[model samples]
Target: MSSSVGPGDGSANRDAEFTETLKSVAGMANLTQSRQVIREIGSSVIQCAHDRTVSIIVARQVLDGLAGKLRSSGSDDTAEADAVVDIADYLLREINAQGQSSNLVDQTVGLCEVAATAFETKEEYTEAAQRLASIPLDESRRRVSPEDKVRVWIRIVRDYLEVDDSTAAEPYLNKAKGAIFDVNDAELNLHFKLSQARINDAKREFLAASASYHDISFSPKLAEEERLHTLTMAVRCAVLAPAGPSRARALGRLYKDERSVMLANDFSILEKMFLNRLLQPKEIKEFAETLQPHQLATTADGSTVLERAVIEHNLLGVSLVYNNIPIASLANLLGLSNDEAKTEAVAARMIEQGRLVGRIDQLKGMVWFEGGEASGQNGSGKTAAPVDKELRYWGANVQSLAEEVERVTAELQKQFPGFVEANLVV
Candidate 1:
């Protein structure tokens, strides 16, 4: 009653049925259905390969078919996109185990790009960048040109920065630099320069960053908005730079630029006011009020720029007039509160940095400028009456000691003439 179909016949029938099912799945208009088909194919491939020792050629066909379905599914659907990545992972393993293919490297790279795009869409920027970097650039069969290699390297730099890892970006940037040689592309060069500037800024080398921004701003090929933005950044860097003539020069250049007028802020005005020799403490205070919290240096008391400026100004003002003043009076002149703690904090900074040469006496409530006449006198600020008894006794003791030293030297010379000539202690 039973008719036997041979083992080979049953296997052939199953394979033909699978091929037909794959074709039908490929033709389905619904993306969700298409993903289900790919998943089914994956399951069948694994099952058949284990039970019947499916040939590598058949496995390759199934993989290629799955990739085709994935391409048709598009990237917008999360389920379909993840399925594509899963299939790519399987294909990669198969290709690695079964030996290389002429087209496999390209296919692998394509899959990695897809995976990276998916990760990027999810805001997993670090993983996305890593996926792109895993491409086999050194493969002899890789068809990517020198320029494309540089592009890849540049992307790595950007990715590293997205995660705020400049230390990691640096090696990749160097690789990009090496790859860019002999590549005569202006746009790529600009991007490289911009990335370099950003890296410098992230590293807190504002002066170097300003120089880079200045260079990029002058490029005729850049857009007007971008050029102006770069110039504004350069101005900020110049302002933030340690006070020096170069900072003055940078600010001067920014002030003279017509483009700077377009920036709607007090940055330029602040820079100008800070540089003027005749600028008063009141003007500095007025300008300081306009800056945002981030623009000023912070202390335990408050965010203050004018505090430091007024302190320096008062020190200079007093240096020009009265070099000797009580600490309380100095505090009052600098517009500081009567609190000696606040006064000492401000004055100590200037004196410690050698910007002011002075000494403070907290107990006596006095400050003595190095060159002031009061410095040579006692704290009463009056010269002592001439030669007290105690002072004369000290002077006599010093004179007697000097006379005894001279007599001892003469006696030594008389006793040992050659010894004195050869080994005289000066």
Candidate 2:
């Protein structure tokens, strides 16, 4: 009679074979061959698990075989899990070990799914997030650009927001803002703008949302779809702003223009409806600054007047020795003839008097005056009496210029206190 080996002995032999095969493949320097061998071993283990005829001993052998494959270079967690799903309890211990390893993302993610299906727990979801975070963000210009950093940040913010963790979300949103400007691609910029608008809208900061929309609308590099969406947001914000005189005018202007109408119809409907009411005085100021002088003049009323040209001559000699029109541009604006405009003549006289001392290259075609105060002498030094007169005249002119500037600045402050604060005059 021959001594026959038991099922446990055969299972142990198979397990030893699987382990030896895995060790051989892992030790090989050729990655491709090792992967092929691992796959073959994994398939055989999975087949054994599916065979019910195999005893618990055989099942253990199969699991051990799958785990050995997992340790191999080409072995993945999903494959390992699939091969041993029948023995989840046994697999759980192995899964935890794999999850803790640096090279176990595929296995961890697979384990997460299995764990979620088999056992629902808060830790599972947390583990899933952690495993997902571990995957290095693929760096590619076409697919996952640097601009996607903002999108990732925004997604994180939304997740945090869902948990009512606004404090945590705020930093993510701020990071998104900083990332948006760093992107070079125009298409990405439009996406960033839209994301910002959505975030602002969710925060109920409609004005900021509207401004973001406006930026998208006027973006020179944005795609057509992005531009349309941006215009829509602008129109919507305009309507949502207060319906005062300024808002009404802005809405009327936006509606009358072809670009505005195109944007109004294509962008969000809610934005269009609220566009007129969202207009801020600061927005109006920004818009006004971009317009030409003629455009601004055309919109002026009885209280408005064209701004006077900046005269760069001494105030004393301005009326007498020099012409009323100081420069060619000023002369043209004032509707004076070339001869009547003594800009050049006055400049020449100043040069002779040493009041305007500079290189001929600097004074080739224009008058360049230096202040008498900058000449390094007081009134009593040279040409004593005339110097005193010059000093007194300059002092009065400076005082007068200061008063005028102060008055204009005060008026600007009343009209736009926020603007004045941001742009304090030196």
Candidate 3:
């Protein structure tokens, strides 16, 4: 392989020169020559990777060049893809063969990061995150600064997020969260915020995610198109949030953001939410098409997240149009499968939980909308004193019923005393 002299290295010309040489050796068809390159890369080449930006760029290019070489060898089929991945694995194997805590410990840490970038380029996010996580950042082994820790943790978080592995990403997210306050880099801070928002969205903390995303959409660092895309994400998260007051505020904010009007498909639903208009099944189905698998994941009661959101939203809509509706009819409005009990249970739970801001009359089989907090279900998770309000209403109703019965009995005694006497103790 022909070598070029000092082609824009990440650090000193010597280190860059050495790395550029490894890139050439990586492309060689001979396996023996390729096998020997890992020692140089895992040691000298990697030890020089202090300039993270340039190091990542050059290292990623080296892996990309190898992948390109493998592809150029023959057919554009699955086997070629496998071969590309194999080359990356081969480098890791050779490095690990030398044992982990060699004199080149720093270089080993850097090499893992470099290898991870290659996996990420292939869209093998799980592997990429695993590669990055292999770095030992425990202060005992390596005393990494808070900023540095945040950098690596955020990278791992971003890769895990790509595969929707929020559970796995969580510990690292906490680690980053604790360390991020010390980080002053604008770009890194933005990345951390964005990652947190993604995790929230995946975990179905949609209202929090909506607020975070909307905040990000206003960042000056993003391009106009990117801002619009972020705004769209904010809308999606808000829509998925359980129907309640917090979600209402989120929706109201987005509705007022003139840019929301630019969202072609999402704008329709946003408009429905703003006006308390009922959403059609087809319209929700269309919006659901754009959701991630987790967004459609089923809840405890066997309904999907989208279905739950729609049911809650529709119930609020029904309350808006009717002062009181029968449980059976409410079930129809919510598109529940003739399960009046299920519908009643759902409505009652939302009301009692301080989500729906209304009440259900089980005996009369009716939903009575007080209509005070229409846009505000207080849903998703905001605490309010619901028990006191409900109990007060219940006490007032009991008193009112007694008064009406007494007044009716008085009229009966004055008009039909014999009939009243036959039925009453008095």
* lDDT preference between candidates 1 and 2, better one: 1
Among all windows of 10 consecutive residues in model 1, the one with the lowest summed lDDT is 373-382
Best by lDDT, which number?
Answer: 3
Ranking by lDDT: 3, 1, 2
TM-score of each: 0.56, 0.31, 0.71
Q: Which scores greater on TM-score, model 1 or model 2? A: 1
RMSD of each: 14.4, 21.3, 12.6
lDDT of 2: 0.44
Q: Report how far off residue 205 is in candidate 1 (Å).
A: 0.8
In angstroms, the error of model 1 at 230 is 2.7
Q: Tens-digit lDDT track for model 1 on 260-366?
A: 77876635453553454334556656656654343465645663443554455455447446656787887777666666667665555545444445666554666
> Clash number for model 1?
0
lDDT of 3 by residue, 342-372 (tens): 8876776677556666666556777677646
lDDT of each: 0.63, 0.44, 0.74
Clashing pairs in 3: 244-377, 245-376, 245-377, 245-378
